[model samples]
Target chain A: MNTDWKNIDAASLNNLTLGEAEKLFGLEPNFTEEELKKVRNALSRQYHPDLNPDSGNIMSKINAVYDILKNEIKNRRNAEQNNANGGATDTSSTSSDSTREEPEAENINDNAGATDNSTSENTADEPEVENLNDNAGATDNSASENTADEPEVENLNDNAGATDNSTSENAADEPEVENLNDNAGTTDNSTSENTADEPEAENLNDNAGAANNEPRNENSNITWEDVNRIGVENLTLDDARRLFNLEEDFTENDLIDAYNRLDRIYNPMNFPIGSEEAEKNRATMNSIYGVYTILRRNLINRQNVQESPTREDTTNQSTQVSMNPTNEKADNSRNDNGDENSQNIPSADNEKNDGQTDRPKDAPTHNEKPALSTGPTVGDQIASNDTTPDPEPIPVIKSIPAKIMDHRKQILIIIGIIALAIAISQAINLTLVAQMARNGNLWHLTAGVAEKAALHAKNINLTSKLIALKSSYDSLSGVWTIAGQKLLTGNLQAILRGISAGSGILGLSCLTAGLIKKKSAAYKEYKKNIRQLIRDFNDLSYDEAINQINSLRENINNSNELSDREKQLLLNQLKKAEKLNRQFEDIDQGEELEGGMSL
Target chain B: MMVDSIITLANNKNYLLLMESSILDDSYFLGVLLDDNMEPTVDYVVLKKVEKDGVVCAQQINNLNTLTQLLEEYGSEYAENYN
Candidate 1:
């Protein structure tokens, strides 16, 4: 073999020769010539791909190992030479096999059953040993430098001793399942045998293509990308090109109907009908019919594949599908896109209408002919040039416009977000303030007032009891004076009337004083003022309520006509009522204004 | 004979694998492929194990793709045509 083989791992092969291969393959005690041939044949036969084509890489490894051992006399001799220097490894090998070979009980039974081919097997191995002996004198086998165009190597058919024979039997016996790789060794890529292998590859691909329409199975990990690539690669481009020659038949009626419909519906003027774009569309529509024709032809081709007869009617292009209606529809469609395009680029259309072409004359032009050699053909040149944008260098405005668009989009989005936030906050605030105002707390204040009224009623009760006792004392005095005078005199009656009058005046003054319990309220105006204060407070009129409460308390404290006890009671009551009013004044609604609470 | 049941049993979890090892020695796409997990497939049929005895095995079965193509197109048709 040439030393410079491509892709061989030089280091790995070198080690196999002298380094550690024997140790690695667990063949430390070198194989005797006889043993090596047997192992090499066994391994090679086991993995030979042809023996088990389905084995894939498993057989290749076995084949590879056979290569190493087949001409391995050089390596075995290397070890034998090592032993000539009296190495213990060499002594062990001779010593061990001798002992094992003489095992009388096991040897006799094993040889007895094995006699079916033992004599022939031993004879078969003799020539191989002679080769090894020859190589011992000269380490390199002459076979290594043999002719490059080597004849095909025969499969070692001594398959029974060679593991292959057993597996083939194994494979044949079990028809239900295929045997795995000939042997365990990994094999190489099978690309070279194109003719023999092509069948399997196609089978796999066909299965893959139809697999898409089949329900998915879990073990199948194939993906659409895999199938699509396979479909494309496996496709015979030649087939498609040939499809053009096939007869038309599959969608005959429908194609004709569509053609007729388009002819009637379309308006050609709307299309700018003679324009290149319209012509291109027209070409595309014609090609579609071409595809339709091709597809119909394929139905027959497909039918052939299905082993079915082709549909025979409508041959020779007799049924020309009506092309009129679709032609009209195509024109109408052209008009719609034209109008939309013109509306979008009014400047272009407007210039065209003005008879001044849309092309800017002063624009820098590249790869362009001058429109004017001051030539009469300037109009034609300008129109043609206007229809095609000058292949000029990229414009500065293009970059600037892109940047401006990005910034514009970003700015608009940010501003829109900010506006939404502001509107949301305003709405939430309005809702909360409305809710707070409606919360009134009027009932809570009414609750406070009821408590105050209960206290005042207690005070009034005590005062009235005192006044009732005083009236009884006056009545008794009138009775005593009468007892000392005439039994039914007019003077006695007058004295009793005077006592009653004094008691009524005393009671009325006490009641009036008690009712005006607080200092500043003009008692007659108290209800109206207090009510107004409550209304102002609920309406967020806090400052006004505070002003009124303070004024009432101040005025009451300063008043001089009251007794010390009544004044103290009035002050106490006013202090509590004012405290409640102040609490309302300090109700910070959590919103701040530039000025104090608006009234 | 086994695993028609096994085929049914292989369920979604089972997959068939057949790889050519000879490619690793030299073939561009084939040689380097490896399954680190080492879960071997039972269903696939590997043909012409890549290399054997210091020679590439696939050299013997060239034009494999063609045979596969013929079978795909003609296999079913033959069955129906003959039927």
Candidate 2:
């Protein structure tokens, strides 16, 4: 027997019946609870997957059989208790004789008789007698009808006790009895008294039906009401995946495919409208759609996280903020403009804009180029004119020609400083270029020497020396080739050196010209005017400062004494002053607004 | 009986076709066959509807490799436009 057990395969183990399971454990079918437990523990130790790696199938089978036996024992005990409680008068003899009847059959008879007697006599004393008689009659009839299987039932009864025998027989006969009862209850209207007497029996019959029907009951238990109660927001990722019959690693396409298949299967249009099946399918479809929506959102969010792992927190915050109506509008406007500043800025005013009113009319749109004429000139005006008024008298604005002639020396001096800086930088660059050229020449010489030495070694049959020299030649040859290419392509470094030296010489000449210009009479007059203008603007209010700067700029632009380049330089300074004044105004306004809001 | 037919059809590289849709209609399906000993083997088959005996029948495509090849060739385009 032990050798036979060892020879049994997984398939045989899985196929074990209750009788076979008992034999596998080396026990009789009528084994006591303690005996069953002892055998199970011993078998589990022998077949545990941890100790025996290939014992998974055997362990699972053992566990499965144990669960079935446990449930059977529990049901048998419950049945005996119910008999003792409900049919106490007749149970002493009937329990031993009718132990081969199923617990469900007994339960139905007990309930039915109790209901019948309560209806007829308004008393429950005779309920147990009636119940016992009904069950006995049914079992006797079934046993007679299934005479061919009587020996098997008798064998079970003799060896495994009456409860085990009943279980085996009931499993085979319960469905047939359930169907018979259903037909009798429904179509046998002629037996009105019987119907009236045993109304609860039909329900018990249904409850006792096969395990295969349990899944349908389970599926039907989920209703639209339940789905609504557990809203999409509350559904977990696992629940959604289970609904779609999908795995964790499923992609967006996989989710879509699952949804499509479910949609096709539960399509309400496939059923007749307003029918129960149609209503059920519609509810199922809605539930599926809810699941699909949740899973799709999860898939999208997962992909987004994977694509930008570094930006997850920022993305989540942005998504949360974007949910607000105000922020959503602001985001849409910013997105439409495609401006980096619009995206980067997180101001309340931007949120309030809603596609209009926020952006300046003259500001560039996403596609349009900045209007260059207005940009610098308007900036110059804003910087100069948007300042506070001064208590002191301001200097009168001069004509462009007068302003230029006055500051001519200062301008020349600025030009000389710029030239000197350029000359110094160019001299440094020229030195670096000369060093690079010398390095290239040295590399070229080394390449030629290595090539010749490789040839000399090869001619003398010095193999190792030749190989080493060849390697050096190869490396130096690459550098030499690059140098030769550069030389062929116009000796770029020499050209660079020449250009640097020429620039330095030109810078010296400019410095010399500027120094001569700086000693002129016009230079002294313009220097005083410029210094006075700066001192007056320093004490002025924002408006006054802006006005004075704009007037100065007009003078610079209109003056014939000033060249375009000189005029441009003066206007740029004005633009900077104007920007500074505007920024000061904005800061002051912001502070006032914040103070007001706080109050 | 169904298990016997499946095993026979599988060995012969052929499969049964149910000549009417009765709940099981899909691009892919899994069928479980329980032997006399109640040991179960699961097989995945692709379902294709075809006209057999002048009636629409869901024919089980038993060859997994063939199904995979076909899916590889056309699955993406079909999935994208299925809606």
Candidate 3:
């Protein structure tokens, strides 16, 4: 029996993450019930053990992955449902109690009600307490009033009067609501509706503070054992958050608070360096810092992705293309990727195509891509909310020729600098050689003086003195002997002359070669730029054509050694480009003139 | 006969299972390593394939370290077959 299972191996399945597990089963993290059902049906048809009995192991892996994802999705849905139910319950309870409570006490009552059930009892028992006070009043008003009843009635009336005074002075308590709103970091509009029927949010801060205090207490009491026990090596984002004692929906402020708190305890400065305890503390601090940084970076990336998925996709693809080793292939792949991404995503595809055609080189900048901000806003709803199959943006890949054109100036400048350095060093060597030749002449003069002295001694018939002078001359001459001069039967002086001549010739040749290389490289680059300019002219990119022509001219002018013939050739090309540009302008002028005539 | 056939294929044929998760599409493939005789061997191998300019190239995942790095960079759906 044939099986359509993807054929995952054992090792691969061993370390699968929840996200990867979802992908393996072809389930989206936020997949709807219908989508999940569809995926389940499709996988079972291909990998059901009974259907494809031969691939029992493969079927088991599939079921295992599916089960994990199914449970995860089920849990997420249950959480969302519970949140919805709890919100509804809280709202109903607030509205019901606010109906009977005094306006001034409503804010305090709402806060107390949200935190504990004591406010519910307060509201429920208020009417009964008032009725008891009324009965005591009726007894005191009777002819035989009990002394116990009189004091009770007075206490009840005092309580009623106090309640009445507080409720009647609700306007005076408005300033406290403002203070509460300020403390809560909420809008003043919430406090503005206290006189209206809506439940004032004055108590929200107090209740929320009470609710947060419990978690804050627990988190503060978290021990080093709780933190150090979490292994940082394979720590995922969620695990890192847990180690930091952060909530499920932690904000940047919360992350910073956790980091600061953790850093204080684990800071190695508290311990002596080189100690085992210090080392352990240092490691703990590093892990905390790593977790904080990773969380922060992931949060920023998620924001960027959520704000403009296509732009992020485009940026990634461009980076990848830039990193590619093979220029020609990378260029083609980038274009293909752009097109492919465009097809996968609808709105982004339209924008990408518009960008590709509108400004082939610089269009991506002016197009909708740069307009996308990193911060998410409601304005991006129209652009980003489209149900594009893929969220990745297509990378605009320029061909090798275009990229070379962009960097051609920089390449030439670098080459020029290298050539200049070589020439300067060679010139310095030439001056040193001249100085060495002068030194050699001074030695020859000394030898000539020794010969003169020997001749004078011979004239005087001083044989010993003449012999000494001759020996001194021979010793002085031998110092500059070329290697293997005697074996070659060459005169030492002649060989020395030959060595000087050879070096001089070699230096001149190298200087010429360096110059020629620079000239030829520049000329080749100029030709390439001219060819690109011509192509641009043909493509009716007049502005780019003009720019290239000016650049080419500038390069030629900089190349001082360019031959007259080469300069003439470049000038002719420039003339042709300028003529074409003029023709384009004339054509535009003619169109305008025709329009004017018709008008 | 079916069980024996499955066992024989598993023991004798060098089969590499791979999944290519790309932006365009995700595809599953099996690569069979050929021996000196240009025939399939029992020893399997895993390779990382990159396609550029319509040309597809692959690099072998030789060790556990390489495999771990590959899984981290790419997703777990991709695996290299190795002997």
Candidate 2 lDDT by residue in tens digits, B10-75: 222333211111122223322232345433322223344434455434354423222322222222
Candidate numbers sorted by TM-score from highest down = 2, 3, 1
lDDT tens digits, residues A19-62, model 2? Answer: 56566667675666667666665664466432344442344345
Ranking by lDDT: 2, 3, 1
lDDT of 1 by residue, A236-317 (tens): 1111111121112323332322222221111111123244322322322222222332332333233223233222212101
Each prediction's interface RMSD?
37.0, 45.1, 25.0
Q: How well is candidate 3 docked (DockQ)?
A: 0.01
Which CAPRI level is candidate 2?
Answer: incorrect
Which 10 residues in a row give candidate 2 chain B its minimum summed lDDT?
B16-25
User: Which stretch of 10 consecutive residues in model 1 chain A shows the poorest summed lDDT?
Assistant: A590-599
The regions of model 3 sitting more than 4 angstroms off are A1-227, A233-239, A242-254, A305-599, B1-83
Candidate 3 accuracy as TM-score: 0.18
Tens digits of per-residue lDDT for model 3, A466-508: 3324222222322111211221233433322222222221121
Q: Which sections of candidate 2 miss by over 4 Å?
A: A1-21, A79-599, B1-83
DockQ of each: 0.01, 0.01, 0.01
C-alpha root-mean-square deviation, each candidate:
48.7, 41.2, 39.4
lDDT for A137 in candidate 1 is 7
